[model samples]
Each structure stands twice: as structure tokens, then as C-alpha cells.
Target chain A: MLGGARSGKSRYAQARAEAIAGRHTLVATAEARDAEMRDRIARHRADRDQRWRTVEAPRDLAAAIDAANGADAVALVDCLTIWISNLMLAEADIDAATRDLCEAIQRFEGQLILVANEVGLGIVPDNALARRFRDEAGRANQAVAAAAQEVQMIFAGLPQRLK
Target chain B: MLGGARSGKSRYAQARAEAIAGRHTLVATAEARDAEMRDRIARHRADRDQRWRTVEAPRDLAAAIDAANGADAVALVDCLTIWISNLMLAEADIDAATRDLCEAIQRFEGQLILVANEVGLGIVPDNALARRFRDEAGRANQAVAAAAQEVQMIFAGLPQRLK
Candidate 1:
């Protein structure tokens, strides 16, 4: 699933995972490194109950997915852009990390849904890092959407399939 | 029409304006205050022929439209958010300006197509000015969309009618 902020992509992903018969796990890539982000994470946690087994994976996303998935498990990676940011902040290789993550996604046997933001729909960022991040995010979305059997974009809280 | 940066909203608007049988008037709200912006305006000028009579309305959009509209005219307002930004920079009353613009739109005699960016579908800006601008843009879009006879959203270079 792909959407802009507050477009209900996370909610839609959670709902889809819950509909499937399996152990539901939410692989959160957001790091509460700032006060505002911590509040956002807290709100997200308050929205879901113990029904979701949550894993914090600001990095090492593939490993988290590998560990969380099982025959009867359905894991949802809550977002990809944050993970990209984490990788950039950590000086990790973006292409290599994206490759590893995609491989893990392809290798995983359990049902999975990935959430990413559609960030390319706005103005060109005025700074270099923002522009690079936007480009990287667009590339990541294309790679994931191509590999996945299904792709959807959320607009105004409504879901529209793109693939 | 509403879309992201480089999403062809301007091109689409220009094309729509060209297709209509009337005196084509482009009410551009952009101010070429910078070199990059000047280049952009130049490129836009090159794209259209002498058929388009351009009006540069960085602010006072209502007056621009009221003056541009004619019995044999079709006016295309290239965007609203930039006008909003201009209004903000000039310390213009946003609500009053919006009200006046809507009134002018309602009273226009020519065929009209308005373009605006879908700026609300992104992460909340961390700064107060950006946040306020986003809110104002959203309000402006809603007001314009409500008054218009038709509305459409563009994604991935495709158009979807919303009303």
C-alpha cells in the first residue's frame, strides 16, 4: 500500500492484515528520535491493541521481517521511507539495503503488506538531502510495487489499486 | 485540476484551455522573484503560442479574473496556492481574499478552469508558517472545489474526476 501522510495507508494496511487468518505483526520502521515523532508513535500504539505483535525495526528491517514471519503469520511493514531515512542517517548503502529488503520480502513465505508514502506528488524540495530522499523513495516504491502482486494508492482516505 | 510537482497539471490545464473555443487567457499567479522561477516562466511562455493572453496576478486574483473574463474568453487560472503564498507574503487577509476570489469566480462570464496543488496529503510541516500555509491551501481548495461545477485529481499523470 502507498499513500501520502494521513491518507489512511497505515490503517488500511492494518485492516488488511487483520482480515487474513494468521498472526498479525506490525514492523514499525519509525524511530522516536524526536518529541513529535514519539508522540506520533504513542498515538499509533494507542490505536492498536495486543492483537498486533509490534516489532521496532528502524534498521535491520529484513531481519525483523524474517523473524516475525511464520506459516501462520502475516507481517506488515508499516513504512519504507522512514527506514530509508534511517539508512541514510546511519550511512548505510541505500541500494544494497533496498535490495536486501526486497529479497527478504520475496523470500518470506507468510502473507505480507508493505506501506510507503507517495512523496513525489509535492514541490521539489529546496535542499539536496530532501531531493535525494524524494528520489530514493520514488525508486524504492517502484521496485516494491513491481515485485509485489498487488499495489494500491490511497487518496482522500479511499483506496485505489494501481496494480 | 490538482496534482503534485511536475505531475503535468500545468500542461493539462494549458491543453484544456487551448481546446476550448474562445480567447484563451492564462491567469498566472507565479512571481518570478528568483532565477529558477524566471526560467520556469520562460519555458511556460515558450510552450503556448500567441493564442494565450497572459496575466501575471501574484496577488489581487479576483481583480485579474474580473478584468480578463470576456464574452469570447476562456480563462485558466494556472494555480491558487502560489496566490495564497503571495497573499501571505504581502500580509493580505487570506479569508477575505478567498471570499473575494470565489465571488469573482462565481460572477465570471467566461469559461473557467482552475488549477491547484494537492498540498495537504503530506507529512505535517514542523514549522508554523508551513503548517499555516498548508491549512490555508486546503481551505482554499475546498472553497474553490465547492463552487466549481466539476473537480478532478491527477495521479501518475492520469485524471480522476471527483465531482
Candidate 2:
């Protein structure tokens, strides 16, 4: 699912993941690097409850998803943008990481729903890094969307299936 | 209609205005105070042909709308957030201005399409002024949406009617 910040993409994805009558795993990409982000992570954790087995993977998302694969299990990757950021911060090859992640999603023996933020809808960021991040996020979304069988966009707490 | 910045809200509004087989007047609220803004304004102006009689109204939107009112005219206010910002920077009474704007829309005889940016979707801003602006923008959107006969949200160039 694609959406802007606070557009209910995470909550809606959680609901969809919970509906599947099988093992559920949430691959969380956000790190509690700051107070505000910690608060957000805490709130999301509380919302998921014990039903979702959580995997903390700020990087190595493909490995995390590969490890969580199970028969009849459904894995929900909470977001991709943060993962991209983590890769960038660690000086990892973004193109390689994205490719591996897509491969993992395709090879996993269960359903997968990935969430990503649409950050390109605003004015171009003033700094070079932010602008590059925006461009990378857009490219990552296109790649994943092409690999997925269904794509959806969330707006104002409502879901619009695009494919 | 409302949307995120660069989400094509202005472009969509301009296309809609062009299609109206009547007098079309575009109320522009952005001032070209900087080089970047000047370029953006130039591009927008280039996209709009001579058919669109432009009214530059950084403030006093109600008066501009009242002036542009015509029997067979469709007046499109390119944006509302910029007007709100103008009001704030000038220390004008936001509530009073909003009321007057809504009253103008209610009293206008011609079709009106007002565009606004969704500014509350991101993380809580670090500063009080930005937070205040976000709150004010949200309140303005709600007030105008309540008065509008039809409300739409533009997402990735797709228009989704909300009301």
C-alpha cells in the first residue's frame, strides 16, 4: 500500500494482515533513533498486539523476510522508505538491496503486503540528500509495485486499489 | 479539491477550469518573492493560456472572488493555504478571514473550485508556528469542505470525490 504520512496505510495494512487465517509476521523497518520515532514505534507495536510476531529489521530486510517465511503464513512489511534510509545511512547499495527485497517477496511462500510513503507529492526538498531520498523512494515504490500482484493507495483513511 | 503539494492539484484544477465552456478566471495566491517561486509561477502561467483571465490575490480573496463573479463564469481559486499563510504573516484574524472566504463562496453566483494542500499528513512539526499552520490549514479545509457541494481528493493524479 502507498500513502502519504499519517494516511492510515499502516493501520489498514495491519487490518488486512490480521484477516489472513494463518501465521502473521510484521517486518518493522523503523528504528527508535529519536524520541518522536520511538513514540510512533510504541504506538504501532501496541496496535498490533501479540497476534503479530514482530521482526525488527531496519536493514537486512530481505534476510528478515526470508527467515520469517512459513507455509500458510502472511508477512507484512510495514514500510520500505525507512529501510531505504537505513541502507543509505549504512552506505549500502540501494539498488542491490531493493532487488534482494523484491526477490524475497517473490520467493516467500506466503502473502506479502508492503507499505511505502509517497514523499514526492510535496515541494522538492531544499537539500541534496532529501531530494535524492525522495527520488530513491519513488523508484523503490515503482519496482515493488511492478512485482506485486495488487497495488493499493490509501487516502484520508480510505483505500483505493490501483491494480 | 485538495491534495498534497506537487500532487497535481493545481494542474488538475487548471485542466478543469479550461474545460468549462464559460468565462474562466484563476485566482492566484502565490507571490513570486524568490527565484524558485518565480520560476514555478512562470511555468504555471505558461501552462494556462489567455483564455484564463488571472487575478492575483495573495490576500483579500473574498473581494477578488466577488469581483470575478459572473453569470457564466467559473472562478477557480488556485489555492487556500497560501492565503492562510498571508493572513498569518500579516497577523490578520484567521477566523474572521476564513468566515469571510466561506461567505464569499456561499454568495458567489458562478461555479467555484478552490484548491488546498493537505499539510497535516506528515510527522508533527518541530516548531510551534508550523504546527499552528497545520492546525489552521486543517480547520480551513474542514470549513470549506462543509460548504462545498462536492469535495474531492487528488491522489497520484486521480480524483476521488469525498462528498
Candidate 3:
């Protein structure tokens, strides 16, 4: 699932994931570096039920997905952009990380719902870092969309299927 | 049509507009405020054939659309986000303007193609102005999509129909 902020992507992805009859694993990418972030993370968590086993994967997401792999597994990565941001902050090789992610996504037997923000539609950022981040985010989304069996873009709670 | 920066939205919209055998009107929202913008506008202009008549509508978009309305008119609004930005900079009432634009779109007889940036998908902006811009842009987009007969979100040059 791909969408802008407040586009209800996470809500849609969660609903989709919950509909599947399987073990629910939420591999979250958010890390509470600040109070606002902590509150936001808490609110998201509140929407999830007890059925979901949370796995904090601010980085090392591929490994987390690998760990959750099963015939009846339903893994919802509550986003890729935050994970990408984390990787960037850690100075990790983004290309290699994205590659690993695609590979993991391909090989995983679970029904995966990968949520990502479509951040490249705005005017070019004033700062170089912001621009670079958008570029990486857009590139990663394209790569993932190519790998996935289905893709949907959420706009104000509406699902528009792309694949 | 709505899409991100360099996501092939303009190219796709141009192709769609060119396909319509009508009096082509390119209602452009961009103004050359700086050298970079001037160059960008020039490059975009070079893509059009001699058939298209240009109308500059940095803020007066509704009037431009009204002027271009005809049974055989093909009007392509190159963008709406930049126009919104111009309105915001001018301290114009965004909601009222959006309402007027939507009304004009509904009343238009032309084969209309609208371009807008989906700017709210990324991490929230650090500044208040950007956040407001994204909010206004998103609201305007939803309004436009509702008014439009068809809506599309372009990604990597591929068009995905939304409505």
C-alpha cells in the first residue's frame, strides 16, 4: 500500500492484513526519538489488536521478515519510508538494503502488505538531504511495486489499485 | 491527473491532451520567478507543438478554464499545486478559490486535463508553511478529483485510474 500522510494507508493495510486467516506479525519501522513520535507510535499501536505480534524493525527489516516467514503468516510492515529514514540516519548502504528487502519480499511465503509513503509528488525540497530522501523513497517504492503481486494507492480512504 | 515530481505526470497529461483533436489550450500556472524556473518553463514550452495556445493562470485559473471552454476545446492545466502556492503567497482564501475552480471544471465543455502534485505522502514538513501547503493541495486535489469525470495517479510514467 502507498499513500500520502493521513491518506489512511496504514488503516487500509491493517484491515487487509487482518482479513487473512493466519499468524499476524507487524514489523514496525517507527522509532520514538521524540515525544511527538512516541505519541504517534502509541496511537498506531492502539488501533492494532492483541492478535498482532509486534516486531520492532527500525532497521534489519529483511531479517525481521525472514523471521516471520511461514505458510500461514500475515506480515504487515507498517511502513518502509520510516525504515529507510532509519537506515539513512545510520549511514547504511541504502541500495544494498533495498536489494535485500526486495529479495526477502520475493522469497517470503507470507502474505505481506508493505506500506510505504509516496513522497516524491511535492515540489523539490529546499534541502539536499530532503531531496535525496524523496529520491530514495520513490526509487524503493518502485522497486517494491515491481516485486509485489499487487499494489494499491490510498487517497483519502479510497483504494486505487495500480497492479 | 495527480503525481509526484518527475513521475511523468506532465508528459502523460500532454500526450492525453495532444490526442484530442481540438483547439489546444495550455493553461500554465508556472511563472518564471527565477532563472531556474525560467529554464524549466522554457523546457516545458519546447515540448508543445505550434497547435497549442498558452494562457498564463498563476491565480486566475477558473477564468482561464472558462475562457478556454468550447465544444472542441482541449485545455490542459499544467498544474494546480503551484497555483495554490501562488494563492497562499498572495494570502488568498484557498477554500473559496478551490470551490470556484471545481465549479468551473464542472461547467467546462472542454476535454480538460488537470495536473496536481500529491505532496502529503512523505514525512511531515518541518515548517508550518509547507504543512499548510500540503493540506491545501490535498484538499484541492480531492475536490478536483470529485469534480473530474476521471482521475488518475501516475507513477514512473504509468497511469493508474482512480475514478
* Number of the top-ranking candidate, with TM-score as the measure: 2
Reference-based lDDT, residue A101, model 3: 98
- Mind giving the per-residue lDDT tens digits that candidate 3 earns over B92-140? 9999999999999988887999999877876569876887787788778
Error of 1 at A113 (Å): 0.9
Task: Give one digit per residue, the lDDT tens place, for model 1 in A1-163.
Answer: 9987655678778888888988888999999988867987998889886889899999899899899868888999988989888888898988888888888888888899999988876666777888888888889889888889899876544567889
lDDT of 1 by residue, B1-163 (tens): 8777777888887887888899888999999999999999899889988988899999999999999878788999978989999999998999999999999989988788999887765544659788778767766776787678777778667888766
Clashes counted in candidate 1 amount to 0
Off by over 4 Å in 1: B1-117, B120-152, B155-158, B161-163
**Model 3 scores what on Cα lDDT?**
0.90
Question: Which 10 consecutive positions of candidate 2 chain B have the poorest summed lDDT?
Answer: B152-161
Q: Considering only N, C-alpha and C atoms within 3 Å, which residue pairs clash in candidate 3?
A: A4-B121, A121-B4
For model 1 chain B, the run of ten residues with the poorest summed lDDT: B117-126
C-alpha lDDT of residue A158 in model 2: 98
Question: Every model's DockQ, to 2 decimals?
Answer: 0.12, 0.10, 0.22
True contacts kept of each: 0.09, 0.09, 0.35
Task: Please give the TM-score that candidate 3 achieves against the real structure.
Answer: 0.61
lDDT of 2 by residue, B51-149 (tens): 888899998999999999987879999789888888889899989889999999999887899999887866677778887888888899999999899
Clashes per candidate, residues 3 or more apart or on different chains? 0, 1, 2
User: Runs in model 3 with CA error above 4 Å?
Assistant: A6-152, A156-158
